[model samples]
Target: MTEPMFWMSVAGVVLAYAGYPAYLVLRRSLDPWPVVPRAWTPPVDVLLVVHNAGDALEAKVANLQRLDYPAQRLTVHVVCDGCTDATAAVARRLASGRVRATVFAERRGKSACIGDLLPTLTGDVVLFVDVRQTLAPHALRALTAALADPSVGAASGELVIRDPTGFAAGVDAYWRYEKAIRRLESATGSMVGATGALYAARRQLIGPVPPGLILDDMWIPLSVADAGYRIVAVDDAIAVDHAPPDPAAEERRKRRTLSGNYQLLHRLPRLALPGAHPLSLRLWGHKWSRLLVPWLLATALASSALLAAAGSRLYLTLFLLQAGAYALAILGRRSAWLAGRFPPARVAAAFLSLNASAALALGDYLRNPRAHLWQTTRYQESGR
Candidate 1:
């Protein structure tokens, strides 16, 4: 085959495989139909995991107090691990006795902290909430109602990024698109993973996470799914929080997330279990493939570069196009601040940010295969 033809063929194959799956996810996400059932109240335990979360504890506690569900039926458990700051002190000051505060001065990972608190949970359902975010008043009811369906082992709310400033608006838009796709996947059946900021599951469905698991969001949902129940997304249930103001801070967050994805892929190979639903497949396509995308991207790029240097104009053009597309995406997101608009450019930026972080994460994971303690980034103040 001619050099040009070979490069064209390779590009076609990659586009057909990777590009098609992404199209399907985007198409499904754009469908504007409701998937969640109407709200009904059920007893649930609200698990708030905190580390050095000073005043933010107060806002989270206040949000919990404002939940539309019966206050008596709801219990809030705050797990404070390795917190030297007044996080524990602030939580105690706000506790009405309905809130149980578990303070551990010794630093254990968040996953381990969660494992420790699991046995103390007495509610029929447990909802994990990040101290930095606030749950919608009706989020609990919606999540609980979804859990009422026996097939749903866990349910997560829609995440609304509340950064009104342009600093992280790009990040917010990216999440909006993601949430849309997640909803569509859920409607088709099951969510790939629950949002860590706000997700609820049956207490019995909870299992011990690998002590070093960095991505509780991925692990918890996968565990529930492996147990034969669906991991669901409830669109009506919403949690509002801001993205990290600094791009560097956001990148740091993504790095940790990527590392967790790698760890989970290794520890929970059961994601390939039989009788997997479409949502599970979507999860695999959208997330699992993405975990290895960096390697695939790198290989393709290198191969294209070599083939082009060997006088394959077609292959060189294809490789350059892909690279240019990513470059434009990044530029578009960064330029949004100047233009005051959310454009197609931002979408490209979001993609670039995600994949770039994935690549960095793979490098970091390779360097340190063992689980290590890492600090969570504090982006915005948690309004108590």
Candidate 2:
């Protein structure tokens, strides 16, 4: 039983990283995403949140103004949350016609600020975005029309990481895999969440996020979906942001996000409960299983080592393979030759960092959920 369980854990990892994505490509090939016509133009509120994004606010505003959507039907609201810098000032300077700016004095977390401010906005659809990404000319229109099905509660746009240098990064590869998963989920009309960088929701579905919560993307879309509406992914509506320059930053971001997954399952236990959600199997396979990856990896490593010690040739080979990959990850961190710029190093490094982050996130979750929550709010206040 132990040996079988060990192999099962190994199979889970393979299925996750390999089989799942292939299944999506096959599923997509058989049934592609439905075409959403651009004709369904509706009043859109571009709700942008920023901290100290003074450097990028003006250009981002300009980018939005360049969008193909009708100016009369579109309104841009930039909310500056505890921005000590000239973020609000820059936005206010850029504010003209349909663009507006508001400043929040307190350093509340984004979820709280958005929850508080969402009530004041009146648009047929509220499109949420961060200050970093710049959308394509017709991205907004595509997103709006995706919701024309009326069955869609929210529509999440694809994010394209700017890799102009064509540098190979593990997170870049991961996003490609993630995009396929999103497409599969969208096909079933049960994508679990939206990309916070660019996604739109029905105005009526907009509501106050829970206090002390992070990951508004996951929470908001799930909330809307619970009301019997579908969450779809729109690959045509693409937004661009630069990829993280280093694995350290990527790990930090993943840690924060993984920690929020814990909180999400806690806050909305029904999401993980079988028969509770249409996406329950997918959630476990795509999202929640990820939370167990570190453990799965560890168990696979230990079990193989144990069996190898008892003179199993196959387990010995597996053990050696695991050891070699982990060694490569350590080398990737220390040597420039083995760094994230190359595919092997990047893939190995990304795998190592991701599992390490999962362990750290789980540790943080266990140690002090409230304290971590407090720290996250502080971080989100400054860095977002």
For candidate 2, the per-residue lDDT at 353 reads 80
Give per-residue CA lDDT, model 1, range 27-113, as digits (tens).
Answer: 567753334455556678888878887768887888898999998889998888788889989877777768888888887777888
* Global lDDT of each candidate: 0.73, 0.78
After the best TM-score superposition of candidate 1, give how far the Cα of residue 364 lies from its true spot, in angstroms.
Answer: 2.2
lDDT of 2 by residue, 33-70 (tens): 55354467888888888887788788788888899988
**What are the RMSDs of all candidates, in order?**
3.9, 3.3
- The candidate 1 region of ten consecutive residues with least summed lDDT is 272-281
| Poorest lDDT segment (10 consecutive residues) of candidate 2 | 373-382
lDDT of 1 at 328: 74
Write down the TM-score for model 2.
0.90
lDDT of 1 at 30: 76
